[model samples]
Every structure is written in C-alpha cells, then in structure tokens.
Target: MGLLPLNYRRPSYVAGSPRTMSDDQISVGSGGSGGSGSANGSNPPKPTKLATVVAGIPDALGFDRIIDGGTCPPCTTRDFMNYLIYVERSAENLQFFMWYRDYVKRFNEAKTSDIALAPEWTQAMEDDAVTRIQREQADKIRKETKTPAIAIFNGTDFEKRREVPKAPGSDTNPFSSPPQTPNDRDGSSDYVSTGEQSYRAQANEAFAAAGVKAPFTIQPFRKEMDRVIATYITDGAPRQLNLSDREQKVVLHALAYTTHPSALREVNKLAESTLRRQAHPNFIRWSICNGNTARVIFARVLGGSLIVVSTAIALALTLSSLGRGYRAVAAIGWVLGIATLIAAWKGMCVVLHGMHHHHVRPWELFVSEEDADDLGKRSFDSFGSANSYEEEPWVVRYHKRNLIRKIFDREVWIQEPALRQIQDTIFLQSMLCALLIAGLLTAIFVASPKGNFF
Candidate 1:
C-alpha cells in the first residue's frame, strides 16, 4: 500500500545463502555512504548484484505490470491474498511484503522521536486524534445552534425518526408538523442501528472528558519488531520464511540495535524478489486456471471432440461419391470447434460473455461455510445488499443451485472495464481465428481431388 523506500537497494545473494559481503561492509546509519566513509576513513562499499530467485520466468511476465495496472484483483484485493494463504500455503511472502510496505510508509512519515512507535500504533493514534477532533467540532456546533442540527445526523438517522408521533390533541406538533427536530424535517423511517455508532460516541465522550491519551513509547515498537522477527525471520517460526541462516542473522543483528526500516532491508529485498520472481507468476497462472468454471472446461473438451468429428466428416465427404461442394459444409463444424477451443484457451466463457456475468471463482465457492457467511456479511456491510458485487447472495445462491444450475449460473457481472475489454478482445480474436481456420479447411476440401482426404 505504501511506496517502497527510495534509499533501499537490491542485495546480492545466492540461492539459499546470505549476501556475499559481511554486515560490517554495509552502513545502516542515517547519514548514508558518507557516514560509513567517515567512520572507516575509506571508500563506501558498493552494492553487489544478486541472482534472481528463478531464471526461466520471462521478464515480461513479471509482477511489475500487475502492480502498475492496479486493476488485477489478485494483486490488489484481499480475496487473492486469502487465496494465497488458504489455497497456496505461501502467505508469509505476501504478509512480510505487505508489512514492510506499511513499515516503510510509517518510517518515512515519522520524526526522529516517533520512529520507535509501531506503525499500527501510530496509525491508530492518528485516527483517534482525527475522530476526537471531528466529534468536538460536532459538539461545538450543536451547542452553538438553538435548532436541531440536521448535518450532524446522516440519512439513516432521518430514516429512523421520519414519522414523529403527533402530540395527542395538540394543534401544533412541536417535533412533527412544524419540523421541530431534524428527523421530522427530513421524512424517512428506515433507521437500522447496529449500536456501533452509539458505542463510539460514548467512548469518544469519555476519552474527551478524562483528557486521556494512549501511551506513546518505544517499548511497543520494540515488542512488535521482536514478534515480526520471531514470526518471519527466526528459524522454526510458525510461518518462518524460506530465508537462509545468514540472511536471518543479518536481519536479527540489525534489529538488535534499532527498529528502523533499514534494519529489515535485507530480508525485505529477499522476500520481495522471491514473490516477484516466483510466487507471482505461479499465482497468475493458477488464477487463470482457477477462473474457468466446470462449464467452461466441459465446453473446451466438447470443442476438442467437435474438431475430431469435423475432421472425420470432412474426410468422409472428400472420399465418398459426394460432390466437392458438399465437403465445404464441414467448414461450419471447423468454425465452431476452433472458436470454442480459442475461448477455452483464453479462459473466456462465450456464454458468460453474452450474459455479461461470470460465475464466482472456484476458490470463492470452495471456501468453508463459515468463511462464506463472514465474507457475505462483510460484503453486505461494506457495499450493501443492492450492490451487484455483494458476496452474500452469491454464496447462498451457489450452494442452493444444483450441479446443472451451478454450471449455468451467472452471479457477478463483469464490472471491471479492463476485464470486460479483455473478454471482448478474446471473443473477437476467437472469431477471427475460427474464420481463418474454416476458410482454409473449406478451400482445401473444395480444391482437392474427389478421393483426396488430406
């Protein structure tokens, strides 16, 4: 989520080994190369070029494009990260990278004194300060204004109290007819309370009344760094990274003195490079394969069968007593077969294209019922029920559908413009390829001798 540190440079290392240069050779001081040079009274050590984790993967298919595009769900969304954690069993690489990104952001934003605070703690403190300020402003406005402040309450509040009960036998309803309250002024009675707003307001008031602030200290950051090291960098950790002993030792040694972003630079580079060169390509390929529903796969197999059948039919027509023109009819089968194969290869379902919708991905459908319920609830809470992208209804509907229905079900719409464009391109390409293949087959059938089957 945060930009990588500009000062960070790639480290040189071999497979399953730490950097060739010793820790003494690299400087972690704030003054950069000059600090190292001043201390040693010698030229600063130059960075070494490290070999990539994997070599066969082409540069063009690297993760940079995905990160740049900023639209691919796998690279951008939590769902993909969930896939990596639950399905792929390689979550630490992503988890470490994500944590490091945030760490870099906090480190960059922090002052010298604030550097010792954990990033999460710093973020929470900032959020609390903002919330407190906003609440104070709202309270001040309410106190200054004689009339009820409509701006303080959102639409949901108005909806809940739209119809104020008229005072019995009263000529003028103070809170209703004359719009005495903000709720009566804006008519709607659909207020749904989750109690969270009231709790937050009460907590904010209590904090303000007491003039209390969360403790800010270096201990929290040090503890957080220790936990991070234990979980990721330390050997035999619960989610220990595939780092070499030397790499782990370097990070541990650096963190011994300070919790600065520079402390974990070596480990960060290793994790990032691993994800970029190895995990990312595998994720992309897996996502493509996983994107295809059972129906799509069936269609692909059927297409291959059609190709075989079409070839046999064309051969029969050519070898039989039928006229050369009759053999050209086989072009229709060739066209259908080629088109279907193309669609299959691209993982684009032709039926889903026309419907402008797609089935929930296989990983989504296969999640545990509890996870599905949680996902649905979160989706509903964040985006509401009317949103087409809401997950709850899709999960429920997916389970309710029979095998045949599931195969045909179109749940989520192709909402992303880029993805829609890709499908459109694939469809068009398939058509052209099919047409080309059909034309060639037809030409050969018509031009060949009556007995010729080639």
Candidate 2:
C-alpha cells in the first residue's frame, strides 16, 4: 500500500511573508514581491496599492477626508500627537496582520504534515522495527593515546560526547600574554542585581569582553521614529500605511475604542469588511480626527464667527457710549474687550476632531539606532550597521529583539488637563449662547410704548 497520498497538493505561500498554523506567529520573509507574482503564475496583481489601503478603511469617523489632499486645517500640538499615534498604530497593526494570516497558513500546512507521515510509519511498525526505533546508540570511544592523550570523536556517541584535549598543539603557548590595558567591566545596569550572580551574567560579560554589544540595552532609533512620524503630518492628515492583517484590525479597533483594553486580541477576518464599514474614529483627544468631526468643525466655525461679530459690535457701541453717562459701563467694556483680544491672540484656537494621526515612512520602524549619531547616517533600505549601513545586518533577529525591548519600555509624555479644559470652553460658549437667547426671549416687552399706540 502507498504510505501517503500522492495527490496531496502542498499549499503555496506568499513569499517573504510566511505564517504558521495554530499559533498567530508570523515571520515575514524576503517579502511577497515575487510570491505575489508566483501565486498568480506571474500574472499582474488585481491593482492593490496604498490608495486601496486607504480606501479599504471604513470612513465612519471621516478620517479619510483629513488625509485627502486639500488645504490642510491649521495644525496644532494635538495633531502632532495624534499623527504619531497613527503612524505607530499603522506599523503595529500592519505587521500583526501579516503575522496572523501567515501563521494560519503555516499552521494548516504543519497540521497536514504532522498526520501524513506519522500514521503510515506507526501502522507499518513490526516488532523488530519498533525495537530498532527505541534503541539508543552505543558510545564507541576509540581511545588512541598519543604523547599527550586527547580524546577523539567518532559518530558512535550521538547523544553524549565529552571532548578532551588529545595533546597541546605545537603552537600552543599556555600563558601567551595579557592585555596591556584593562577596561571597566561594569556599565549599563540592564538587569537588577539581587545578591548571587548567576552563570548568565558571566556568560554575558564573557560575550561582551569578546567585543559583543550588550543585549538588553538594545535601544530605539529615536530619529527614525521622529522622521516617520513627521511624514504623517505633511498634509496634516494620516496617510494610510502598509500594515499586516492583525495590525490593521488592532489599529482599526484602537481608532474606535476609547482606551487600550488589552493587546494581541483575536479578531475575525470574515467580518472585517463589515466591521470597517463604519467610519473609523480618529479622535484621541483634540488632535486626532475621525469621520465624525464634521459637527466639531461646524461648531467651531460658528463660534469663531460669533466672537468676531461680538467684538465688532462691542467696539461700535463703545464709541457711542463714550459720549454719554454710560462711560462707566464703557470703561468696563473696554477692559473686557482688551482681555478678550489678548485671550484671542494668545490662547484661542479651533480644535479639529476628525483627523488621521498616523504617519508611516518607508524606513521608519525598521531602524534600530545604536546611538543618536547613527540615526542621522544609517541607510533605511535595510537593517544595516550603525557604523556602516551599506548592508543589512546578517544578525537580523538579535538586533530586532533589542529594538523591540527599547520601544516597549519607552515612556510617553502625558498632556496637562488644563490645556484640554481650555478647548472644552467651546462647549461652555455654546451653552452661554443658548441661555442668553432664552433669557432675552423670556423678558416680556410691555409692548414698546411708541410702537403700540393702543
């Protein structure tokens, strides 16, 4: 009987981006560059591009409009903050989405592979075959003693092989030399010391002594992040970036959700289109805008117009009041006018609500700065050395892990509440206008004497 089905078609995967099944672990390879081509037998793609990425997002929050090319709204500090968040979220979500889909695919392949060869071999086992499978290899040590006895290795010992020096080489000089200069072994307290030193520390120091960079201290390339974030503000709107599937969902949710609940949450791919159909909210305070910011904009515009009109009217009336007994009232009015003018000059601003806060530069998140100086010089094409960015680091995993740790533990600046309350004054103004209208209407005009000649 045939051991396994020959009709099995191994699933083809997107090149550069591979995923595992069962777990959401994803590993991006050289990229889907040729794989996308190969998958469709070298045919052209269905025209997916960055524009499609932007369009695919549901505009419930009107975030798409902000990113639209037009006269950008007046920029503010909050906009910068939101833009940074947007870029960060874009990178994060896109990466995860790539990871998740890739993982599921790999998982399917793995699951299929696990059963295919296992069942056939298990059922075909005879008593002798079973015994052979279970048997352990015997250690065959050929003890050849030379002038200085050194143990030699043959393949006889598969599990355990203890190598001993056969004899000192002719070139061996035991105490050759010591370094002329000794350097400080201690710096960068990466890990907390809690009494006894573990073997890990020795290993780390030994590794470092041999000129290896410290592992835990792998820090962030701040300049790259800043550059990437800055790009998102060009039109003062978030340009949708390339993100993985999981990342897309997370950011989409983050855009909608008020607070971060938890991370690494499972999201449904099937319902993604439906979920994204609603306009995604961009507001995370005053800076971020979503599709829903129309009301906010209109309100602000009307309020600003009102303030201008009010100032003009007060100025005109004050000129008249200067000629009469209303001079005391005019004095007070002038003081109020000056205060309002100063406030308008210094503190007044219209806050835009629906805005895209994410920015993504091609080389933004990929960089890991060894130092601040390295940030200004490195080529972002690939993960190159801080010293020379001519080529991507062969040690990608090691460098990347360090980069992630640095970013993960990074601190963020929390905005003061006072600034926020200042913006909220718009709401107060709206209420004041409503109350004034009501009070004036309520005061009964006893019928203007001259008008009602009753």
Candidate 3:
C-alpha cells in the first residue's frame, strides 16, 4: 500500500516518460499532482509517480511488481478495478478509462486509412436523425401499399413484426407423409433456421438481404460511442460519472463535431485523475481492512477474554488459600493474552503470522456467482480473452465451506517477501511485549499477600 515519494520520477525511456507517447496516449499529467496541460509546443508534461505506475512503468521500488513473482496477471490492477466496481460503486471512471485505451488503439490502427472517419452528433441531432429515418421508412411502406396508414404507436404492430418467421416446411399438414430430401437422408444440412439465429445475426441478415448499407456518415463504431455516452457521460444514466458541469459540457460539445478520441480528451483526463487520486488509494486501504482488520478484531476480543479469565482465576486462587505458586499458573494466560492484544493493536493476525498465510476475505468469498460471471464476460468483451479477468479458484472453494471452516481457512500464502518481513517484525515485537508484561504480572501475583507458598 506504500506510495512513491513526491519527488519520485520515472526514467527518460520509460513508458510514462514525456518522450515515449503523447500526453493523451498514456494519460501522462492526468493525475492530481500532474501538470496542467501538454500543449503550446511547450515541454511535455512530466508524468506523476501514480500516473507512471498506472501506465505500467516499473518504479525504482518494485512495489507494483506481481506478488507471486510472475507478472502476466497484474493482480493489483485487477483488484483495484474490481474494488471500484463492487465496493466503491464508482465503476464508470475505470470503465471510461479502459474504453479510452481501446479507443486510442483503434484510432491509431486506422489513422492512415481512407475509411477513418468520425461521426458527429449532439443529443438533439441524434433524436432528429432517428425521427427522420422513421418517417422516411413509413412513407416508403405507405407508397408500396397504396393505402392510407393508421398511426398506432401502441407497439403491438412492432412486436408482431419482430417475431421470427417459421421455416417453409414447418407448416406442412401433419397427417401427410413428409417428402425426403438430401438433408433428411443425411439427418443434417448446411442450412440453419432463422429461428435459431441470434437477434444480432438476424438483423445483419435482414440488412444484407435488403442490400441496405447505412450511410458512411453514420461512421464506424458510432453505436459504441453512443452507448458509451449514454452509459457514462449523459445525465441520469445508469452509471453517470461525477464530472463537473464544465467538463461534461466540453465533452458533449466536442462530440457535436467529431467522435474522434480527441473529443473525449478532457473527460479522460478528469476520469484518470479521479481514479489515481481517489479510487486507487481508497482501494488499497479497503483491501487492507478486508484482508486483516477482521482478524485483528477477532484477536482483540479473544485476547481481552483471556485476560479477564486469567485475572479472575488468580483472584479465586488467592481467596481459596491456594499457594502463591499456584497463582503463578495464571501467568500463562497473561502472556498469551498480552501478546495477542499487542499483535491486534498492530493490525497483525498472530495465527496468520505464524502460518505465513492469509485468509480469503469475506467480501471476496461471498461474491455472487452472477456477478463473477458478468464481470468475466465484460472483461472478455472489452479487453479480449488474453486479458479477461477471472475470479481466483480459491474464492469459489471458499464459498462452499461451512461457517466454522470458512472462519479458520488460511488458503492464501504471503508470497511477497516484503509482506513476510513485515509479519515477522510484528510477531517479534508482540512476543517481546508479551514477555515484558508476563514478567511484571507474575512478580505482582507471587509477591501479593494473598496465599502461602506451596
């Protein structure tokens, strides 16, 4: 969870360096500590430490390195995005950032092509276009029928029109003997029924059959851009982002002229800043709490209970006229209780420290199956199969365990050397504190004028 110092800087040839890519390409200078702009032929803006880390640049300290030593998965980034979506409920920023990355890649690939074109629209423009298209289609249908059309907008006709058409042979009389063809003889055919086609496939087939190509003005990826706007940029959207009015206006205005990635530059910068400054740090803190805080609380409660029981036993032993030596037996509980309490105060789980493993967090274990599947599908759709995110296998197994077994589970090893060192340091400190406390308490118990030596 440690962050880079304020003065930390990436090397000149690193991915986040000013010379590596444009400010917009890697989102350099888009964080809170980043410079204002990378314009006016001025020197390129220096990338902030957080920005560099996010851009996949390795820092001087390997804090961002993969914990298990292999680097393919980048678990920290995956966990950060998952936390934003599931815990913080601020997924739009990450979604927008990810979408922007893909957009940039596509834009670069097509930059030199003749088909590289941009769509332009405002809310009013889009609405008007849809209305015009509908009116034209209705006029064409009327002219073809040569009948006065009755306008019924109740959607009944629309639903009927959308129903899939039955196959030609399906409506034959059932009592008649069916004619055998090549397909029947083989029990298979190359032909696929329209009813079996997905809605998207059916729509594409309809358009192709009609020889109706949409106008080039519609632009490639126009539908995707509109979806992104509706889902993340527009007010009253399902996951509308927390953007400033000025920033929102800038984006909408830019879209009025072009759907190029440049149209989203300002909004992209703001989203990146929000993720780095707020969501990323908050995710780290939440991760720590989810991973260790519960264990600490359990330790504190058990430790306090032991301390109380130990004190009561020593008092009972004195009152019963038992020897002072017998009262010393309470020192065992005192030692363990104090050590556990000290460890808890340091946010260390004594059992996990000793075992060199951590428990699967409750949130991680209890994630709904639907959510996991949806996340996996979204990741695959957005980033492709190679980078698709999958829930850890241990998470599924953890969910199947009973309550008692779940509480005692320690399946995740502390793979990071730094984390192991930290745990060791905490354990050593707790033991020293326990010994000091036990010696003091034992001395008081043996010297008290409560019972004779046995």
Candidate 4:
C-alpha cells in the first residue's frame, strides 16, 4: 500500500552540532581589596566572551527527499499534467500540484503499514481517507467562492473590479460580492469576487460598473496546457527521473494507462518493464475484487447460466401449452435466474443484502476519496494497530438493492464501463428470453386449436 513499499529505507539520524564555549576570552575582575591587584586601581572593561553558535541546522525528521517537481521524477508538474491533468482537467488546478506531491510522499510511506496487508480496509483507514478528501474538497470550494470572474489590468498593472457586461448566453458570475471597506487581513478597499468567471463581457461589465477608464482590459488565467503538452510530446529523449525500481513500477502502472498522449509517449520512451506493459486499467480494476471474491463471481456466472437457460425453456413450454402451465417450475427458475444475474454482474446477491463472503463490485472494493483520505490519516496516527471495519457501526459491507433500487441506482455504476458491459449483457439475455417465450406463445395461439381457447 505504501508508495515505495519495495525500496523505501529509513534514513539514519545524525545528531545536531553540540554547543561549545569560546576559549580565547576571559572575564577581568575588579582589583581585590584595592592594594595587591593592579598598577592602576581603575576597573578595566570585562573581556567579552562570544558564544560560538551554529545556525541552519538540517531537518532530521523530514523525509530524505521531498516529493515534488524539485525532487521526484514522475511527480514533476509536466508529468503530473500528462498523467492526471489532461484526462480530467477540471479536477485540478495549480493547487493540485501540492496535493499530488503530498499524496506521493504518503503513498511511499504506506508500505510500512500493517493495514497494507489486511484483507479488507479498516474503519480507521476509511475515516482517514474520507476526512482528507472532504477537507480538500472544502478548501477547493472556499477558493472558488473567493476569486472573481475577471481581473482587470491597466496595461498589465492590475486595476479595480467591475460588473460584467450583459451578454446573450453568458453565465452568472458566482464570484460577485458586495463592496466592502479595506480590512487588515485582506487589505482591499473594494468588494471582490471569489470565483474565476472566464468570460470577456463579464469583465467589461465589472469595469463599467466601477466606471473604470478605457485604457484597462480584462484577462484570464494564462493557461499553458497546450504548450506543456507540446513540449512533453517533442521531448523524445528527456532525462528520466532518478527513481528506485519499485517507485518506477508504481508510477508506470498508473501512468501507462492514462488517456493523455504525453503519458503514453513517456511510457514509450522509457525502457519496457513487464509491469508497465501489463498495467491495463481493467486489469488494475480487477484487483479490486480479490482472488477469493473473483471465484465467487465466476461461480455465480456458472450457476446463473443454467438457471437462466432452464427458465427460458420452462416459460416457453408453458406459453406453448396455452396456460396449462408448470407455474411452480417457472417461478423457481425465474427467481434463481434473476438472483444469478444480480450476483454475477451487479456483484450483489438478492438473497443476502448485507453479508460478507460474497462477490463485490470493483467500486465497492475500493474506498471513496473521502474514505481513502481517512485511511491515510491512520498511516500516521496508529501505533502499529488499526481499527477494523467491523468495529465501525457506520461501515456497510454490501450493496443493498431490490429490482427497483437497482433501476434507480443504475446511473451510479454508469461510469464504470466494464461493469456497464456486464449489466448490458445480462439485460440483453433477459430480453432474448422474454422474446423467445412470447414467440412460442404467439405461434401456439396462431395454430388454430388454441384459438378456440382464446
């Protein structure tokens, strides 16, 4: 679980410089009893004794290396953009660079944790992960609420705020706020917007509202996404970062599957490693369902196939016999078939909603961002022991749903394409079975002898 699990080593502590007294200087004493001490009875100034002091002591408790563009190879701003930014640009801004660096440092440290070896994440881990995520999200929200839509500049020297000009198809500025007197903390004379509104008309309106002079114009944040992307693509043989083999593996596994072209190019530039080559997102996702759980899923699929096939045949036969039916057999078969479908694809058993020892969805296996942050906190807080999931009253072990719940919650799993495919396949099979039964019934009814019964 730790970032550099395979290669991280604790650095040796070197004691700080010991304090020492200067030997050259001595304190002069006043003439003792006036007669035997000095040629002159006047007291001389005491010899100054300067203390030898050492400054700029290195941080001993700090990590041997800071995880940032300055030290980490894979964590460079450019690489960060290539791997994480382009794929989900809106999720990050300049501030995310700091978070990413911290994440790298913590991930590297997690290798030493006993929680890493636990079969399932503990409640402490989930709490740690969730708390951090909520904090980050709140911080982001607070920041967005503070910045204005437009920043005016008087020939590059920033000027006062203004109301945005009314325009068709323009978004309302969320950053707009009432003007306020200058304060000690912020030191601003006028009202300021918190959100960054990225339109030109809004800037013009703000300027007009403030009655600013014509010489001023508004500008947006200087985006360097394309420029960085171009450089990343062009730099064919850029020097690789100095990373241990284990760090390299972890970094590559995450980067190798990114949608960004720059990331893919970097993967190509680096010498091929087995881990990198095999690091498909689906394969990584599969790991979320541990080995034992995967077997349970396969078992569901096997059992479900038989039930679904038998149900289809029984329903078809009942329909062909003109309602002189094997209703009990059909009901049992349908229930088993439905249960199997749910267990195999949804990874939730209809019979056992809140139980463990059942197949789970990939998303279910992984903790949410908030939970992950909470778990991460445990990495530092715990003294070699962590709180188990069972100890937490709030932690739910399984996804609970009836057919209706599944329908409503379908969108929850929509983002997961692999799971989506599984659902789609099961849906298609269900439809085919229904169609087969209908076709058999229609044929029997059309064949004259059943027409009299109708």
> What would the TM-scores of all predictions be?
0.53, 0.21, 0.53, 0.23
Off by over 4 Å in 2: 1-90, 109-111, 115-309, 315-454
CA RMSD (A), model 3: 14.6
Best model number under TM-score: 1
Considering every candidate listed, which one attains the maximal lDDT? 3
Per-residue CA lDDT of model 1 for 1-454, tens digit only, reads 2222323222221222223434443323221112110101111112112233222222322344443344544334454455555455666766676666555554454434433332221323334544665676577567646545654454455622542232132223232122112212222212233442332233223222323421112322443454465456543455577776344444444454455565565566676656644455455444433234667777788789888898899889988777888988888888888898878776766766776566766446656769866754443231122222325454566666676765665356655444454455557778788999889988987888888443
The worst-scoring run of ten residues by lDDT in candidate 4 lies at: 214-223
CA shift of 309, model 4, Å: 12
Estimate, for each residue in 251-366, the C-alpha lDDT of model 3 and write its tens digit: 55455445566666666766766665456544433432213445667889888988999989887787666677888899899988988887777566677777767776554555
lDDT of each: 0.50, 0.26, 0.51, 0.30
TM for candidate 3 is 0.53
Error of 4 at 351 (Å): 9.1
Runs in model 1 lying further than 4 Å from the true structure = 1-75, 111-220, 285-293, 366-406, 451-454
What overall lDDT, based on C-alpha atoms, would model 3 receive against the true structure? Answer: 0.51
Worst 10 residues of 1 by lDDT: 35-44
